[model samples]
Target chain A: MYMVAFLGPNASYTHQAARDRFNQDTCVLSPQVTIEDVFQQVQSRVAKFGVVPFENSTNGSVVFTLDLFADIKSRHPDIVVCGEAYVDVHHCLLGRGAARLTDTSLSSKTDSPTSSGQATPTSKVPYPKTPAVKPVVPVKHVKKLYSHPQAWGQCRDFLSTYLKGVERQDVSSTSRAAELVAEDQSGSSAAISSAIAAEVHGLDVLARNIEDSADNKTRFFILKRTDCLEHQPMHRGAKVVDDDQNSFKSLVSFTVNHEDPGSLADSLAVFKSYKLNLTSINTRPSGLVPWNYIFFIEFKGRRENDGATGAVNAALRDLNNVAKCWRWLGSWESEL
Target chain B: MYMVAFLGPNASYTHQAARDRFNQDTCVLSPQVTIEDVFQQVQSRVAKFGVVPFENSTNGSVVFTLDLFADIKSRHPDIVVCGEAYVDVHHCLLGRGAARLTDTSLSSKTDSPTSSGQATPTSKVPYPKTPAVKPVVPVKHVKKLYSHPQAWGQCRDFLSTYLKGVERQDVSSTSRAAELVAEDQSGSSAAISSAIAAEVHGLDVLARNIEDSADNKTRFFILKRTDCLEHQPMHRGAKVVDDDQNSFKSLVSFTVNHEDPGSLADSLAVFKSYKLNLTSINTRPSGLVPWNYIFFIEFKGRRENDGATGAVNAALRDLNNVAKCWRWLGSWESEL
Candidate 1:
């Protein structure tokens, strides 16, 4: 039986993604932390496969996933690439009865016989009593804005415009924001979150598609133990059979000696000379030391591929002086 | 009187940053939107100075802020950078007394003088009297995780470890997630947000410092209309100015025509020829047709320096085809 792992409490999007990708009968494990843990679970054989988000259209790449690859590759040596999946995002507003402005009865208006025994005339204002649909006044009374960091960044333009100068708060998830707004009796606060959050928490969506850009999409990855799965070619135009195909990409993390001027250039030169396409690069300060930095890089080809495999090994050979804590992260095709 | 604009309702970090840089007497306007709007506010003379976050310690640079420089420079040619300020972030959890843990009082051990009032030994047990201290569990059970995208990204490792396989929801801000969590009475839902959010909506802190990194901070920019203020002298000391100096580094945005490989190299060569140290570089796909790309670059020197300014302009002139839109953003030194 295939065991699929995701970031969870059950109602999370990752869980939904996992369920959609795998069969319902497959056992799904919901951990309380991160995608890295899911990868670890699979590495430890606790789970057969793990699903995680790697990037989003509106927000760019998921840095943490890249960081995780950095961490894993440094420690593990055997993981390989598998597949890829793309998912569309649709945002909606859900809320309790109080937040709804349009009464359902008003939309479903139909003349019918009155319970009092008189024939109801079409002019008599249709069926169930229609509550007045009040115009949503743009009140200058908003005290706070709530949402996930990504959503906030995407809607930064809008928030700065309409809700300018309001208290902007960060939350765990959009759904949690909806929950808080729904529970609060005070109408001064609003949540900038997903429609599902509104539905779960029963909170009205005061705004829709408030993001600065509309091409919002997210990509998720399915990671397995490095030893468990071998590389397989899944991309079109590849002639390699399932047994010899390479599916996962290679990720590496290392640090350049801060004192060296050409350290970064030298490291990058290796890839360029090898004709390797570096997909992503990120730098973070080493918390333990002042002014020191660590770099994370993602390359297009996999370690199992002869060209990529040779370039990485060659780079390692030359980095005897500058590189520190190098590792190879596992590769797998994500099931979206 | 200088008027400073920021994203707000009130008590926003951006507002605080503005107030910290400019005097309290400087008229502050809260506009509820993006940094681009702040530039617009300054350009239109709605505000003399506008403040917006350009980067965070935990997150890298703010892409939108970088994108705005190109847009504003093309439309309003006069705006220039004046100063910068940095601020530290400390998030707290707050709520009403009803949401606080209940304190239990112990009986006095001393004997009373009156015979009717018998002395009782104090119990050794320290127990809370009210049930408020008990973990406020939800009703429904684990379903989803919610938070701002950045917050989620920051706390990704933790979330994946503990909440793996659960649904993940993204909101606009962390405060929104906290607000939503407060409204949820269900037993399963949880939010990864700030302590301040917990206080505002009367919610509990399920976790604290959930972010993977501890030194998380954000940087804000102070901008003025091109025609509003005179150019200030650039700070030339080896050490970068602290928050009090109100000094800032310059930001430049440009686009390289997609026709050739040497285009980007040529632009960089200009900077290198002038001995200019490039601090950072980020490239994004321009939404425009023809598959062009936008590049945001940050350098060590200020635009006010004649040699630095002349070199940049000369480079742009030499490779006219390489740069389609070249403009300098504000130069306020960051406060954090």
Candidate 2:
């Protein structure tokens, strides 16, 4: 049996990604509380493979995932991301079988998240209070919306157009939101969850595909211990490898030296001169230093490819001149 | 008098930073609930200036600060960061005057936050419970610990060495954490908060400067509306500009072309060729595209300086060849 770990609860997006990437029949999957746990479990050999969210089309990058790379590189250098999976995120408003919520219950905490994330500005002298929190007047129809905080951004249009002023209560997950509504047995409250979660929690689907944009998709990375990948223990590993033929892609994470200007440009020139097609480029805090950044770049072709091999060699050589540190995260075929 | 906004409460790190940056006699400061609100309030002219946390010496960058620049560039193109201040973060373990929490109250929700932020992970098939939540062998000494989530990282050694396995509860702010402990009135419960907060909330400091590092410092950015800066409505504007002694620094936020491997490198080359000293570099998701990044670079010298002016022009021109978008945030003297 193969053991895999992903950001969990059985009905989460990560779970869906894991099921899509790995066959459930032979895989024993575990859910980790945090992305760090997912990485830790894989590093500690508690699970052969780990699955974590990389980015969401609507909500944007899963920053902690990028931040964890610094920790992982320092502690667990033997692990690497070897595969990927994508899931179309469709949000459904799920509620209890009951019809309406009590007026008092509907009026949830009126305070909206005003702070961007960290510090809020304050004054010793009370100036004219700025119209900050839009006194969220509870809508008569939908009084409370229970969903993941990230869901609020995705269902913006639906919430404003249909259920304006509905108080949003952020929960652990969409599934948890469904559980909360189910447990509360409140008709007035609704949760934006997955259809699978609605069914699992025995909730009525109030609305389906309520996301503002249809292109909402989340990408997941399948990671494995470097040693496990080389030995190829499981039959599934070979199957996954066989799916992608001679064509493959690689991830290069590097930090450019701030002291040297154009150093990063020259390094990129190596890839340009070699005619490598880059699919994506992202930056994460090096975490080693306060403001320095580490760039994560995904490009077409495998390191083993003749042309790609030459580019990798030249880029590595040139990058040494411009980069403070660099690493080859992994080379894997895009299963997209 | 100039109106400024900062992160809430009278003694929060942001509040302290604001008081340090702006003259209290001439400035009326308003506390915003979130860092985002501070930016939004300043952009909308609700406040003439805003102060928000930029980075923590030990913890790392205030990522949303970088993320807000993306939103500000889109919504309020006229606002710019004008100044900065640094505040030393000193954490104290505070408790109620009543003293001593019951072992029961201390163990009240034994579930530790497994999720990094606010989410929890669950499994489809509940495996044999892996002794997840440690049965807190609640010692009569200390019942529980309450503090901001960030505190857990900073006081790692202290917690592991002294409060090993003591139940930890993550609150909104360290000050809020103190408030909670004070409200609990349980002598057993403790909060890691600022010394000022402990006094404000009427809590006793059980432990002072519990942070693992001695030099824990948080930097704050002072922002102002573009018109306010140019018009010099307040006497302070000229004073701020004059203090810089004709030497100022500028911030440029840009997104490199993914199609061009060396595009970012080339832009940096412009800075190098012009002999401009780059102060700091950070990157955040553009949000316009998933996983793609917009780079924020800080360099010494104002836009008017020949070397700085030439670098900005050359970088913009070269960047246009290989960038999707580019923006100049603002320039000011290094307050340090």
Please compute and give the TM-score of the first chain of candidate 1 against the native first chain.
0.66
Clashes of each: 136, 24
Separate DockQ for every predicted complex: 0.10, 0.28
Tens digits of lDDT, candidate 1, B1-336: 556778542445576666566555535456555566677777777777777776776666666765565452255566666766566554432222222323211112232232121222223112312111212221123456666566665654444444445676666555666666666654345666555556556666654554555566677766777565453223223345443312335567677654543345455555555545455566554545312446666554444443534654554465465566666664545332
lDDT tens digits by residue: candidate 2, B114-231: 3111222234212322211221232225668877777887775555544657788655688878777777744677887898887788877656776766767788888887677442
Q: Against the true structure, whose DockQ is highest?
A: 2
Cα displacement (angstroms), candidate 2, residue B302, comes to 1.8
**Model 2 lDDT per residue over A1-336, tens place:** 878999987789998888777777877889888788888788888898999998887555676787676553376676688877779998887874323445455444443343111123335212322221221232334568888778987775566555655677766688888888887644677788998898888877766787866767898888888777443133334554542323567777887776665555555555656566666666655655544667777776555443534666666666677677788777676765
What fraction of the reference interface contacts is present in each model, in order? 0.00, 0.29
